[model samples]
Target: MNRAPGDGLSAGEVARRLGVAVTTLRSWHRRYGLGPDQHEAHHHRRYTRQDLSRLEVMCRLTGEGMPAADAARAALTVHPLESVERPRTGSALSARAGGGNTIPVGGAGPEARGLARAAMRLDVATMSSVITRMIGARGVVHTWDHLLRPVLAGVGERHAAGGGLVEVEHLLSRTISETFAAVPRPAGAPTPRTLLASADEEQHTLPVEALAAALAERGHRSLMLGARVPPGALAAVVGRVGPTVVVLWSQAPATAAAGQLNGLRGTPLVVAAGPGWPRDGLPPSAARPASLGEALDLTLRWLPTAG
Candidate 1:
């Protein structure tokens, strides 16, 4: 059973967080019986917050020349509460507790993951409840990074694997994308004139809207071209907008369309984001964004470089 206040940390997690070898932690647990407090029926080991803290302190003390036994004793004697912890009520931290550090969907917390599950199961009311609660509580960006992004990524994967039923995937994508665009941007930001388009046959534009939002947030302007844009049209938009960068999204499993980007060489910054980016055969005309976060970084970089 997970003792009150905290769930058990897996053995691997404990070792990684404490900067110790798995073997070393296991040996200490065996020799000094300093292991975590719970072992479920499946033989999965879990440790409390207190247990992890104790281990951390023990490791710190031992690193500073204290003996292992002495370190262990000191660790067991101290218990510092997490900042997110509320006294009296004693509720544990939410999964989104540690800002920017998102736990995986399978891990704890119901807010975002629950919304995702509900959406996947086509439970409309539950999905609405979760999203409304999140927006009411933490605002849009928080919901985006901490919840929406993960959920979309999950949905996309499930859709690929024949998991998204009927029109669920399209509905979820449109709803989330439109919601993102609806969130008000701060007034008179950069507003840089730029075109947002997806390459030929690359129908995924979720990343495009996301990239546009990020750019808008930073004061650069964007013109959303949406999905399935051809290269000639893309080049024309660049000429019309005179944007510092022309952001493109592709999720088609191959960069064959990327070859068409040759028309955009020196006219504008050519940035590409999606799951379909080539690992080895990318042309120099386009840059690959490793993740949404990375895409944001690249956009920021383009701002200063923009004429």
Candidate 2:
């Protein structure tokens, strides 16, 4: 049920609904004079519906990659009661799932559309909050295949066509990497038996990171050798650590040499994941997973004790 009009929300509640930190809320308030008007001196501020409406506009504007001060100026101009509605139960950013103006997420769900919007704005906070929430609710594997990939693919498509959104692509990659890195690896899990790495000269590491987070969700710990490991260096690590399974990812044809697979001939199982690998030349030492789920399944087969 909705609270009465006189009722007000605290800064913490406003921050939670807005998909931003309380510290960020406070910063906006201090920097832009956007704080609650209902409070008198010395008492804590309680945001009224009007205040909530203004902040909602603020979030939407800022999320479109606007300068904070300018967004605040625009938000302040919004008429009270005009934009205020029943605030959604989850993060306010979820309310923006309808905007398909900038990024082309092509027939993907509201969540994917919402994510693509955040990516275009380079709105790191909303993107990260949405991604973390989805991963927690849906598990990492499903989140990767469903939410993340669709947006990433759309970003790629847009980039390929117009040569724009370079900033969006880079920001999205960094945000995904940071979010996946935060996924909790199981405690007291056996020493990591799976090693994940990108093929030599390969700069695309997001897929590898997704597999690592997915493994973590299943109560298995895996070692990550992120991005562009030289063939000799990868071989040296394999020999020293002796992982039961190793997964190598390559995202482009230039980075997919058959020899990278050959370097790990002694490992019990090696996964040559990603489309980068040539169809015919994979050494018997490595197997290719058709998707993220398959990579997890293939790795778990080698490390049967994985939780």
Candidate 3:
């Protein structure tokens, strides 16, 4: 709802106003071919006030579950703030489900609702406070599993469909990962039996980073090799670390079933945690945690002395 006087807004500022990231804005621009009027040298992006206003509306609509392309077209066609809302799929549909599979914390007072909003917006400061509350109440592992996962899953569904603000999700993921990873564990904590890393072609590593951070908080050391770690490198790390539990995240099930699964070898327990994980036909040695909390539970069971 906020706007500056001039018609120009920096790429970072636009992302901040829209509650996303500069990189995300760039991705949207590239993928959907939407943008501000001009760019500075080196291909930096800039938006006029009209452009910013339109993008704001577009992001809002998309966040509410409209596809980015449709939202952009609608934003261009109509006044963004008008009462008439365009019918689109994704966020709007999920929101209209009246709080379906999302966190059931409807009307948990203004603070909780505000926390949810801040999270949805990817406000770093507010998200920090929210995470602190979650950790205090549910412990790091449970908070990650129950609260963060659902919210992020919803966000991811939106992003994949070009409905969610990609930058916001990226910012939130980095913020949460860093915050949780920094929390100290007791001395002499147990080492996890398994390690997890993303396979080649999987660009989404934030989920696994959060999972690793939660595991670390519980006194189980898990190395996060980051996105697109080569399967061969992973196999080497597994050989050296000898982790009992190995976790993999795939945004697409078909990709994992075909190629990413090549990254999973030698580990007795393999857990694939993501929306793309198969509901059935998983190998007996492999399992799905549904959320970071469930993954931590398995980690704790394997390393009972942790925490």
Q: TM-score: which candidate is best?
A: 2
How many clashing residue pairs, candidate 3?
A: 14
Q: What lDDT does model 2 reach?
A: 0.79
What candidate 2 gets wrong by more than 4 Å, as runs, is 1-101
Across 156-212, the per-residue lDDT of candidate 3 in tens digits comes to 666676554667677767777777766664566555565767766677776777777
Question: Lowest summed lDDT over 10 consecutive residues: which window, candidate 3?
Answer: 95-104
In order, candidate lDDTs are 0.61, 0.79, 0.63
lDDT at position 186, candidate 2: 95
> Candidate 1 residues 1-307, lDDT tens each?
3334366777777766654567667755554445675555777778777767767665555433344555555665574433222222122211111112121354424455555544543545455556555655765446667777777666666666655344666666766676557555556555555667887777778777777766655556577888788888877777666777777777866544557666677655677677776666656667777777777776677666333
**Candidate 1 lDDT (Cα, whole model)?**
0.61
Task: Show where candidate 1 strays beyond 4 Å.
Answer: 1-104, 121-142, 160-164, 186-191, 254-256, 304-307
Looking at model 2, report the run of 10 residues with the lowest lDDT sum. Answer: 86-95
* Per-residue alpha-carbon lDDT of candidate 2 for residues 84-189, written as tens digits (9 for 90 to 100): 3322233332222222346676676667766776776567887888788889899998888888998899888888988977888999999999999999989998
Decoy 3 TM-score against native: 0.57
